[model samples]
Target: MSDKKLLLLSSSREGQTDYLEHALPLIDGFLDKSIKNVLFIPYAGFAMGYDKYEDKVNQPFQTIGKKVTSIHRFDDPVKAVEEADAIAIGGGNTFHLLKELYDNELIDAIRKRVDQGMPYMGWSAGSNVAGLTICTTNDMPIVEPRSFNALALVNFQINPHYTDYQPPNHNGETRAERIFEYVRANPHRYVVGTREGTALQLKDNKLTLVGNKPGLVFRDGEKTRPIQCNTDISWLL
Candidate 1:
């Protein structure tokens, strides 16, 4: 059984809630008192500056009684990962975050630390990197990474901020259609369309959907299945 612990959130906010407000209780429960200093990665902030992003994330974490130290503040990020008790990656542009992760050479460092059983938490683009690759990301390719490869912490892909709503009078591919295209192209892969307010938590080789809403799982040659809350999805692990 895998020893890794992860909390992958679809978004920082649910509905009109304040930033990270909805996720505060979840984050508190995920890390617990064992995690004191959380290594924060804010590279996902493209439009917003990294310092601001760090502060934005720090607020909720402090409320939950956890201290946050962003990787950007450190002179050697790899070393920071080595000493971190836990890690939390904040949300933003997926393409930009992946590019920064590659540029900073954190991909392997993070993978190694998390593999060693350090708790890892992420939201939005943050959660996307926990998957096999960034190919299933919902963000536009504003910046290209060295590759679409990610932490590979999980075997499947995750489509964060998944929604079924389409604006009126718009002639665009629906979210499901786009994911179907990905499945058609990669027949061997699985993609989980995780909606807002929902998260996927992995602990002791068990994967549970956290939230009131159900998430959709897509696979090749099979109808998309709805994953209900508290369901064990270790089959995908």
Candidate 2:
């Protein structure tokens, strides 16, 4: 895992901020200066055409002196991944994203690259694929993938855009309850519930939570706990 570098964000925007604005600084810090071009995976943005998605992302990336070329633009996506200096995945529907990845046979190609020291960044559904499996994702199964398994860049599961708030007079499971259910079913695994603005950073064998709010962790037979920002959580890795 020493060669792995991952920045998994809970969401693209945080409370009225511009798209990716809150994450720009963290992205800059995570990426190496040598990385000028980033390969983007826009499969999750199925509602918005890939061309539009790429344009939306490039706007922010250009500000940091980096450029993103969407994988959809390439004839051979696996080859694109192999040749990419870095990779960034955008958020939308996790199921759609996974299905597209499997259809294009890019899961293994991307995993191999990231395992060999390529930088990876993702947000929301994008972040969901970085976990052990997509079972913990908040997204609806609008489409089915060949498998629930994901990148496994980290050892645990991720629940992005996590919130415990129960709206007035609404009868439904809270976010914590859903995560609790997942832990009960998968007793051995850990689930990290990242708030809207938070992110999990893994580099140099160290894992840290970034942002002002604390993240939540849930596991079977263990008390749920808060993960403070800017603290070491490599143990979870």
Candidate with top lDDT is: 2
Q: Itemize residue pairs with steric clashes in candidate 1.
A: none
lDDT digits (tens) for residues 127-201 of candidate 1: 999999998898889988999999999999999999999989999989999999999999999999899998999
lDDT (10s digit) by residue, model 2, range 66-126: 9999999999999999999999999999999999999999999999999999999999999
In order of appearance, the predictions have TM-scores of 0.98, 0.98
Candidate 2, superposed: residue stretches over 4 Å from native: none
Candidate 2, overall lDDT? 0.95
Candidate 1, which segments miss by more than 4 Å at Cα? none
Model 1 scores a TM of 0.98
Backbone clashes (count) for model 2: 0
Candidate 2: 10-residue stretch with minimal lDDT: 1-10
Against the reference, the lDDT scores of all candidates come to 0.91, 0.95
How much is 140 displaced in model 2, in angstroms?
1.2
